[model samples]
Target: MNTIDKRKLSRPNFNDPIPNMKSPSPLPDATIQQKAKTDAVDVLNARTMAILWKE
Candidate 1:
């Protein structure tokens, strides 16, 4: 088995000084999760009704 040197690992140099910049704008609020949950429940209800009405 070959052994590796721990010092040979590469890492980011954060010791250097860097300029501060403005962060990106927040994402838009899309009520997708709520809509999906409601849609799932609607589909489930619809399937249940179909099964119950079937002869």
Candidate 2:
């Protein structure tokens, strides 16, 4: 049986920022809601079409 030492592991620093990384701008709340609704409607339509085609 082998034993490992926990003190030998190196921890990551979350406070440090990476260079040359760009964050994306988020969409407005209205746009986000509209997109989600559109996606749900699309999924429903696809499911309905699949059932109709199988009949």
Candidate 3:
């Protein structure tokens, strides 16, 4: 097998957490609001791109 295939096989899946790693805590309200605002901007940008592409 190639190096890429070996690397892929060695990598851990998302469900398998790394050893000694702690679970993430819940996000603060301000952080959640900031993330929501960023996501909204990303959605708006994607829609604008789609409209421009269709024209």
The lDDT per prediction is 0.64, 0.73, 0.85
TM-score of 1: 0.44
lDDT per residue, candidate 2, 1-55, as tens digits?
A: 1233443345555577865343344777678779999999999999999999999
Q: Which consecutive 10 residues in model 2 have the weakest lDDT in total?
A: 1-10
User: How would you order the candidates by lDDT, starting with the best?
Assistant: 3, 2, 1
Best-matching candidate per TM-score: 2
Q: Report the C-alpha lDDT of model 3 over 1-55, residue by residue, as the tens digit.
A: 6999999988878788676554264887678779989999999999999999999
Runs with alpha carbons beyond 4 Å of true place in candidate 2: 1-25
Candidate ordering by TM-score (highest first): 2, 3, 1
**How many clashing residue pairs appear in each of the predictions shown?**
0, 0, 0
Q: Would you estimate the TM-scores of all the predictions?
A: 0.44, 0.54, 0.53
User: Candidate 1's residue-wise lDDT over 1-55, tens digit each?
Assistant: 1234444345445775654532243533345556778999999999999999995
Could you tell me the lDDT of residue 32 within candidate 2?
76
lDDT of 1 at 7: 42
